[model samples]
Structures are given as structure tokens and as C-alpha cells.
Target: CIWALVITLLGYVLCSALNPKASLQYTFTPGHPFATGVEIDYLEPIEWLPQSHDQDRTLGAFWKYLAIVLSFAAARDWLMGASRQERRSGDGASRFPGDRMQWLLWTLAINAAAVSLVGMLQRLDGTQQLLWTFTNHINGGHGAFGPFPYRSSGAQYLNLMWPVTMGFWWVLRRRNVARRSTSHRSGGDPHVLLLVLAALTAAGVVVANSRGGFLLLVGLLVAVFVLMMLWSKRQVGFKLGVLAAMLAVLGVGGWLGGEALMARFRSEDIGSMSGRKLIYEDAARMAEDFAVLGSGAETFAPLYYFYRKKDPAWNGYVHDDYLETRITFGTVGFVIILLIFLAVWLVPFVGNGIPAPPEFFLLIGVAMVGILIHAKFDLPFQIYSIHHQFVLLCAVLTSLKWQRG
Candidate 1:
């Protein structure tokens, strides 16, 4: 079923790319009265070919999307496929390896921590370039975070990670407690490291000083805490410990970037919606113009030029991913994408039971929730690395087996 959805999506994109009728012809004259200096003299008649205004970009994006989807499928098959040892078990049961998941979680958490550390240090040093190398004149060094010229993007990345790291710690703690119950022995707690890493990652989100990121981080932490308290079989001490850790994360994050965060909140743009209203208004006009077949994939930037009201600058994205999708893919393509999301998120829960530990699923769910909500207010999905990570998480979630835990 997932494959069917994928095939349908790919087919649609290919049709859009191959549409003969969907073309844009224009002429550019320097110092023209037009804001873009290019005047569109003709728009090829729209047909039912899934045509895009910019076939070249749509084709390029299609290939990249196909590659990402295929690669994820291949990697998932390799990881979840039955091994010789599982076959020899003779019960016809198979599960994804718990140790492998743990390793992956650890690696991801450590990497996030390192990136957060770098971003925090960069903010402290007030360097005028990213990594003390590449200059970003638009945002300047203070506004940049880690390697991302846009601090909000960096914050979005960290927001997606810290929750997963916390989930890792929760899984480890649960397993450790289970072991202690059976063995009557207590060993060194390795889960502490995960907690620390999660804290650092959360702090990174705050230090980046993205308003949306900060709010989402707070919401995620609160949700995690509430879920842990309600679902965990552990004692009051463990719950207290978790609460303390969360508070520490908030405290440290505030200390690191509280001044900047507060100043942003106090700024006048806070009430002005950061000029998103104008972009959204223009984007809505574009969507109405191409309500059916859409202008085409990867065509929003160019098509927006026609609909732009106040801003003459090139707007790459609609800021709202859903709105942009509606403008680019049209209602039909948007529905197809929605079906794909439903399949990915719902399939795992449709069988005998959840394929993996419920707690792990909870964590992954939280991560997805963050990005999905962020997409409503920002372009997290438009960014390749962030989009890839989201897809990877979905693939991982679907590939898990109930018997694995």
C-alpha cells in the first residue's frame, strides 16, 4: 500500500515534468518597471498533464525526491530483513535489533549535542561568519547558528532532535530498571549521558533564539514529562529525577540565550507576525490562481513573482509548507501527499499491535509533531536536510517489528 502511494506520487511528478503544454515564456529587460525585470508574455495553456510552469526544476526535484524515497526503502529493507540467526530461532519471528536502535539513538544524540555546542559557542564568540569561515551578510554572524545561515532553521533541527534523545534516555532507563528487577543488581547508569545530551540539544534550540522553536520546545518538553509521568511504571524518585532534568534544561538554555530571546519577544515584530502576513496573502492569491492543477512542483518562487503584492524581493518559499504545497502541487497532488502521510503514520498501528516499544513510538511521534507544526509556520520541509531526517524517521518507524523489543 505504501509502495502504491509512492508510485502514484512519482507518476504524478513525472507527468508534471513531461507535460508539453506547461511552459513559461518570458523576456527580461534591465531597468524595467517590473520588480523582477522580467515580464511574462505568455503562459502555456493548462491541461491535465500534471504540468509545471518550470519543468526543469520540477524534473530535477522529482529525481531528487525519487532518489530519497528509493534510498530510504532500500536502507529499511536491509535493516529490517530477517538475519540468519533469526531464521535459526525457528519460531518464524523477527524483530529489529534493540541494540541497533540504541546505537542509532546514541549516535544521533551525540551529534546533536556537538552541533548545539558549536552553535552556542559561536553565539558567545559573536563571530561574523559561520564556523568562522563563510560570511552570511543577510543574517550576519550573530543571527546564524552552527552551519545554518538561518538561526531558525538551526533551531528547527535541534527541536526535532532533543525529543528523540530524551526518548532514548527513557528507553534506556526502562530497560535498565527491568534488568535490575530481574537480576537484583544495579550497574552504572549509561542513560545519564543521553539525558545530558538531550539537555544540551534542547538548550541549543533556546540558544538559537527562534520564537517558534522555543515555544515548540517548551510544549514538547511538557508533553514528554506528562507522558512519562502517566505511562512510566517507575517510582516517584524516577519521576522527580525526570522533572529535575527538564527544569535544568530550561534553566541552562535560558542562561545561555535568555537575553536574546527576551529581547526578541519585546521587539515590535513580535506583534507584527514578522511580515509573514504579507507573504501569506500573496501566496493565497497564487494558490487561487492555480487552484486545480497548480503552477507545478518547484515553481512557487517564479509564480509568486506574478502574485507578489508588496515585496519585490524573490520569495523562495511560502513560509507555510501546506500553503506552498497547495500552490505548487494543486488540490489533487495535495490529496495524494496527504494519503502518503496517512499511510506512513497509520500503517504501523493497524496490525496486531505496535511494531516497536510504545515509548519509542511516543518519542518518534513527538519529533514528528514538532516538525509538522513547525511546517505550518516555517519552511522546515523545504530544507533538504531537515526533510531527509523526517523521511528517515518515518522509515524507521514503519520498519520496526513488535517482536523486536
Candidate 2:
């Protein structure tokens, strides 16, 4: 199944890249009758092998897609091979050998904490330059967060990390509790640092001042807390701890950027959808026109010029990743992409049962769900860093012992 999906995607992309350009032209009649008609030309739809309007861009995108797929496969194979070797050597009792997962979680947590702290400090300092050096003219530097020009992108990265940090803390806590039963002296709990980092990372998302990120972070935290309460054996202490952690996160976040966030919400543009509705409406028309084959890969910016309602500015992205996929990949390519997504997400659960701790799965699931939801309102998936993090997480999921109960 995996091979079939991969081959199909590869063929689709290769065909789109190599196929000759189409000569189809779309004529646009202005909404106002007094306005002159505009004629726009784009790639014609070919059922067998779709052609992109811009062959070079499509070819470039194909290379990127190929690299991501190969990298994911290589990473998954290496991790899984290591697990198999450990089991054969009879070196560990756990399904995953050598505390590698713990190391990975620790690294992610520490890095996220450091990045979150920097982003928060930057927000407070009111600097238009990213990293206090590279000035961003776009969005007038107001949207700068961390190293990213867009606050939402920074929020997305932090959002992905904090949940994993929480899961790591849970895993460590369980191991420490087990060790304490065998030996009284188990040193200070290292998991405390992870919990603190998780809270700090969550606070970073709030300080990012992205409305979508803020809302999603709150929803994820609430959902995670509820899940933890339901699954935990020791109810009262665990509940209190989780509640306190959540409060600290929210309180810190509020203290840092709550005023700015509130001001954004109070602003008239809060309900305006930031003109996304118009983009969606125009994109729908474009999709209908090229319903079979999309204009081309990475050609939305150029194609949008013909479909835009009133804005003359060159729109770079659809903002909504899913919608952009549909617009650029067309219905056929969209279905192929959809299948690939389903396979990536569902394949890890297809074997006997999940061998990793349920808490780890739950937390990673929260991170994945949060990012996917965020993609609907922003371009998180389009950003290479966020996309790479997502792929890495998926690879980690795939490498786990799904064949074990």
C-alpha cells in the first residue's frame, strides 16, 4: 500500500513536471459591468498526466517532494532497524531500547524552551528586526516572532514542541515512580524541568500574538488536561498538578502578551477573517474552472492574479494550506495527496497494537491535530521548518513498535 501510494505520487509529480505546457485560457468578466474583461491563460487539464502552467516551478516543487519522501523513509528505517537490533541483542526490557526516545524528547524540550524564551523576550523588547539584526519590511516587522517573520509560524513550531514535552514529562514521571519503588534514592526528578519547559513553551505561543495559534493552544491544553484526568489512575494529585501547570502557563502567557492579544481581538479585523473569505471565494472559482488539473505546482501566486476580486497585489499563498493544495494540485492531484496524508497518519496504527506509552501517543496526537487545524487558517505546512518537524514526528510514529501489543 505504501509503495503504491509513493509510486502514484512520484508519477503524478513527474508527469506534471515533464508534461508539455497547456494552451488553455480563462476569461474573467469583472463583477462590475462597467469594468473591462480580463483574459488569463493557464495550463490545460490533461487527465493522464496533468501539466502545470509553470513547468519549472512544478519541477522544483517535485524535487522538494522527492527529498522529503526519501528522508522520511530513511529515518524511519534507521530507527526501526535500531529497535530490532536491540531486541535481538536482549539488551532492554522495554519495546524501544536504549533510552533513545527519552533523549529525543529531552532535546526537543530544551530547544523549545530556549526558542520560546527568545521569542517572548523579543516580543517584550518591541524590536522590528528578527534576532535583533535582520529587519523585516514585510508586515512592518510587527509580525516578527523569534527567527520567523510571521508570528503564527513561530507559534506553530512551539505548539508542536510543548505537547511532546508534556508527553516526555509524563513518561519520565512514570519511570521515576517505578524506580523509586525498587530503590529509595532515585535523585531529584528530572521530569520537573520538562514540565516547566512545557509550560514555558505554551506561554510562548500566547506571546506570539497569533489569534489562530492562541485559540488552538488553549483548545489543545484543555483537551490534554481532560484526557490526562480521564486516563490517570491517581485522580486528585494528578488533577491538581495538571491544573496548576495549566494555570501557570496561562498566567505567564497572559502576563506577557495578553494585552496585545486582547487588543487584536477587540480590533475590527478580528472578525473580518483578514480578507480570507474573499480569497476562498475566488479560489473556489479557480478550482471550478480547472477542476481536473490544477494550474500547476507552486503557480498559485501567478494564477491568483486572474481570479482575485479587487486586490491587485500579488498574493503569494492561499493562506489555507488545504485550499492551496486543491488549487495547485487540482482535484486528481488533491485526491492523491489526500490518500498520502491518510496513509502517513493511519499506517502507524495498522499493526498489532501501539507499543509506546499511551501518554506519548496522546501527546503526539495532540500536536499533530493542533498543526493540522492551524493549517486551515494559516500556511504552517508551507513553511519548510514546520513541515520538516511534522515529517519527523510522523517518522518517529512509524518507527515505534506497532507490531507489538
Candidate 3:
């Protein structure tokens, strides 16, 4: 299941960036197979939504998320029974440092680096692999962006990895410093590799030319600083070192690609109802009308058309995830969403002797905070890669527990 989710995300990112738009379609025709020949096995689950998703792509995303949920159930069961299996199977040694959880983190960090590298190349090489490569079909542009239609989407998607990359980088750095006379993990020289990946991820975000992404990156670093001061006060020098390393990476990255970013920021209208701001105002009105229980999942685009009178552009997303949640899920649904998904991060800190490393959960929590911050400014959830990465992070963090058969 872990692999299924990972491949699913990577495939979407790849297809979105390079494949012809028509090539990645998963038919909703009930019995048809995906373009990749895999059977379409998830229509029923997605159909359970209050209203059918208006588009095939959106419906496909819903199915993928449902698959992740089912996979999570299987993973939880396995975690519960892992102890029994360990006692019966060979190798009773404890699983720590380089276990599945750690490797998963590494996978995410590496995957992020790869994604950033592709985007960087796309920008520098002046190539467009797919139709609507840089310009969202809604908007048109000639320049190369990342795997996304808009540079901001690509930037924010990469920005979502800020915590994961930094977290893994820090973990490996600690491991290298400890040099644990007896190695508990399988990875060797991971610290340097991780540091490189972290730099790549940050550089990618910075070059995407997204003001919001830049703000999110800054916010994440501040979060790391606070976490360090409150929890790992002894690591003062380490924190400073990480900060300096990050600064150097960003300085170089900014030097290479920051002119476009500066131009983008300077070009924004200070007092104007750009389409997004207009949509936001209407979404706020929709939220008030549906304040108790949101209109419904997947209903935003269709319903937004009615509310948005000024532009009447039929915008597909609300631009702000928090507002979208409130408008779709309503107040009750919004709170439930938080409790179900976010509660895991809080549970570890709620108790002492969590058995799991607080740092692991702390990193996950910090990453999540980055998600919320980004969500506030734009609907990161509208992008499959951004949304699924968050789910994957939560699952990995939640699985790191004392639960045993």
C-alpha cells in the first residue's frame, strides 16, 4: 500500500509534467481500465461522494485518495501485528533507525529532490514536454515552468517538501555526528546525500517564482527554529549550522533564478480583484451560506459559478483550501477533518515516553504546519501531488508507534 501511494503520486507528477494530457486519463466508464492498463477499481468509492465529481480528473483523484485510506487500514493492521511476526520470524532485533519508517522518509526526500531537479531542468533547458506544460490551460505562457501549468503550483508543490527534506537532512546529519559506533540503520553516508537533497528542494522552491511558496519556505524555517528552541535547546550550534547551510543554498539559488521571482512579486496588483481574489470573496459568501455543513465535497467548482457574479469565470478551485474546506465541509466537517487527520501528530506530544522519537513526529508536525500555511494562501489540495504527499507523511508518522501485536 505504501508503494502504491508512492508510485501513484510519482506517476501523477510525471504524467502531469511530461505525458500528453490525454495519456494519463483514467476512465470512469465503470468497467474500463486506466490508460496504463490497470483496472479501474475505485469508481464505487468515489461515487459515494454526495455528488459525483464534475470532472474525470477530479474523480480520479478521489479514487486515489480512497486507495490511500484503504492502504492505511492495511498498514495499521500490519503495525499491530508486527510484534507477533517479529517473534516468530528471524531477526528479533529492534527495528529502529533505517526501518521502514526511516526509509519512507528517505524515499520522500529523494522523490522531492528528483521532482525539483526535473523542474529545474525544465526551467533552464527551455523545454516543454507536454501540452499546457507551463501555462495552465486557463492561462497561457511561453516560458518553461515545472511539471505544472503555473509556476506557483510547482513551487508550492515543491514547497510542501520543505519540512520532509529538512527533517531527513537533519536526521542524517545527527546520525553522521553520532557515528554510532554500532550502526542501527542500513544507510551509510546518508547525511551528505540528504543535505544535497535538501538544498535541491529549497532551490527548486525558490526558483519557482512563487511569492506564496517563498513565504511558506520562510515560515517552515521559523517553525524549525521554534521547535529547536523549545525542545532541543542543547542543539543550539546545530540549529545555527543548519540555518547557515540553508542560507548558503538559498543564496546561490536566489542568485541564479531570483530575478524572475522578484519580477513576479513586483508585477502583482496591489489593489485589484484579480480572478483569484474575486473568487475568494465569493467563496467567503458561500461559506456563510453553508456555514454549518458545507455544500458538499467536489461541489465547489459547480457551485462557485453561481456565487461568483463579478467575474463569472467559472473558476474550478477556491484558491484557498481553508475557505474551500469551510465552504464544502461546513464547520462540522472542517473540524472533523482536522481531528481525524491531524490528531495523530498531537497524540505523541500529549504523552510522555512516546517510545517513538519525538523528533520524527515533530518534523511531521512541522511539515503539516507548512501545509496549513500554504493551504491558507492557495488550494494545495487542488493538486494531487501536494495532497497525497501530506497523506503519505501522516501515515508514516502515525505508524511510528509502540503498538505491537
Candidate 4:
């Protein structure tokens, strides 16, 4: 929690520094990133025009680098800390926090509580006062972003993660049923609470109506169930039942709310599938034009505008994060990213023999699949939400290596 808070604070500091004070005081009017419909005085508390050169992503990249370094250092310490003792005794000493999964579960519990509170705030504001006021400007619907001037999609993106964490808590709760039964009945089942939280998150997701969040949730459930069934040494009947239950809970629930959840798929709306496709194609075309290192980091909008002037119907931001990365950083950047992904997925499976920390790997795998799949539709990288999830994963991975040593 402290680490997450630090990272978030750093991110806001970076954002404040990079965004011009004039721009930060007012809401950024939507138009072409390159060309302007009207240059209004920038007096909003948060302006989003410079998103193609997102200060947030830059700040997050710095944190990612730090996390990678910290993970390595932790592993090193874990390995070396007990080596002398092992040599003397011929038996290795296990670390206190040997169960990385437990730590991850705890972290998710904290995240669930935080996100739930935020979701409640969003629900209260949206249903009561902000609905008509925000709708007047947003035109497409707006959920809730904290204090930012723009009606951001980022908060909704964070909300998507609530389900994954809630799921983790659910699994942990079930695992603890034996212990809990011996203790106190009134303690109530954690799994039941998690399920309720997941339901509430579903409601929030439906209200947010993020195409990326919706698609990602679908992909996460399918991937998790299939992976578990394929990998687990469990009965076929048991696996099938688990799969069915997951589908019923997530898929069926989503379907019941499909009217609002799938609203983005209906028109040329802001959060629609068709809109994202348009941005993706443009980003691809821009990448081709810039070639080598593409347009440089944070230069996508300027480059996009340069291209758009020739064609007046252009808008900024390729909604697809992969395409956006390719366009902003070129093939080299794209390849580097792909290799990082290959390491994360393949390293554990190959070296560790099924990844001992089941819950950690499960959440990572789910989130990876979720983000990568969702990025094809929405650029989640622009926000601080997804990066925080990665940080939690890194922390778990670090603690795991510590225990192994």
C-alpha cells in the first residue's frame, strides 16, 4: 500500500510538472490533437490535450524500471541471505513469508476495499448530481474520475481490475474455510464478500461502459478457466464444473447487463469498437510514415496532427496501446516490448516448473491477457491504473524469489 501510494504521488507530480499550468487549470476541449476548432483559454484543473505525449506513461515507465531493479535486488538478497546457513547445516532455511500467494491475496484485499469505496463515490455522484452536468459535455456518458477536469476513461480502467483482485480474495477465502469454521461463524465467508464486491464492480463496469474493460473481463475469465483446467491435475468433472460456474457468474451476469455494457458497440460513440478501429488504423499509418524510431516518445499527437492537416478528418490518439506504442516508439520499441513479455510468460513456466505461487501467477496471467487483449481496443497505458497492477505483481514476484532462496 505504501509503495502504491508513493508511485501514485510520483505520477501526479510528474503530471503537474509536464502539463502547462494554464492547461492544467481547465478542461481540455475535444478536437484534433494537431488542429484546433477553437483555442479556448486553458483554465481547467486538468487538461488532456498532450496525451499523445502522456506525462503519466513516462512516469510509469520510470516506476517500471525501478520495480525491475528492485525485483532483481530482492531476488539476489533472498538467494544470498541464507546460503551460508545452508552450507553449514546441509538444509536450507525457508523465509518467513514463504507463501507469496498469501501476500498477493492480502494486497488484493486492500485494493478491493479501495476500489469499492471509489466505485461507491462514482455511483453516488453519477446517479445524483453529476449525471446531467457531465452528460451535457461528455455527450457519450461519463462515470467518475476523481478531480480531473476531463471525464476520463482511466478510472473505469482501474475499476476493471477490481474484479481480478476480488477473484483473488474469493479464492483465498474459500481456501481459508477450514480455519474460519474452527474460529468464528460470524466472521462470514470471505468468498461471499468477494462475490458481492465482484457484483458491485460489474455494476460499476456496466456504468463506466468502457469497451476495453468489458472485452478484457471476458478475455480474463475465459483464459483463467481454460488455463486452470488445462494445467491442474484435477478431475475432469471438477474442472468442468469450475468452468461452468465461472461462465455462469461472469458471462451470464455480463449478458444480463449487456444492454448498457455493450452500448459502446452500438454506434460511432466515443467508447465504441468502431471508433477504436479508426484510431488504430490511423496510428498504423502514422507509424509507417515515420519509419525508424517512429515519431519519438510522446510525439504521436504532433506527428498525427502533421498528417491530419493534409486530411481534415483526423483525430489524435490511436486507442490501441500496441499500435500506439508501435507508432510512438517504432519497430525497435515494439520488439523490445515483445521480448519483455516473452520473458514474463516463458521464464516462470520453463524454469520454475508451474510457478509455485499459484495466486500470483494466476493474477499476472489474467491481467497480462486482459491488458494485452484490451489494449487492442483501448490504450490503458495512458493511465496510472494498470501500472499499479503490474507493481503488485512485481512485489509478489520479488517476495517469491526471496522465499525460494
Q: For residues 1-405, write the lDDT of model 1, one tens digit per residue.
A: 888988998888888877734455546657453334334433464475687787778898899899889877875665565556556664765543344455566778898899899999998998758888987754423588888788888899998988888877777777767666533224247777788898888899899989999999999998888888888765786788788878888898899999999999899987646778889988988888878877778888767767888666667788899999998888989999989888887766664422566777788889889889999999998888788878877777777634333
TM-scores of the candidates in the order shown: 0.89, 0.87, 0.74, 0.61
Model 3 residue 335 CA deviation (Å) reads 2.5
RMSD of each: 3.6, 5.4, 9.4, 9.2
Cα misplacement distance, residue 396 of candidate 3 (Å): 1.5
What is the alpha-carbon lDDT of model 1 when measured against the actual structure? 0.79
RMSD of 4: 9.2
Give the Å shift of residue 378 in candidate 1: 0.6
Per-residue CA lDDT of candidate 2, range 207-285, in tens?
A: 9998889999989999899888887867576577778889999999999999999988888876657767777778788
Candidate 3 Cα misplacement greater than 4 A, ranges: 1-64, 74-93, 128-138, 141-144, 176-188, 229-240, 349-354, 402-405
Model 1 alpha-carbon drift over 4 Å, by segment = 20-46, 82-97, 140-142, 181-187, 351-354, 401-405
**Residue 216 C-alpha lDDT in model 3:** 80
**Whole-model lDDT for model 4 versus the true structure?**
0.49
Model 3 is weakest, by summed lDDT over 10 consecutive residues, at 33-42
Question: Which ten contiguous residues of candidate 2 have the minimum total lDDT?
Answer: 31-40
Q: Quick one: best TM-score, which candidate?
A: 1
Name the better of 1 and 4 by lDDT.
1
| Clash count of each predicted structure | 1, 0, 2, 7
Question: What lDDT tens digits, residue by residue, belong to model 3 across residues 64-87?
Answer: 656766666665444433344456
- TM-score ranking, best first: 1, 2, 3, 4
Clashing pairs in 1: 355-401
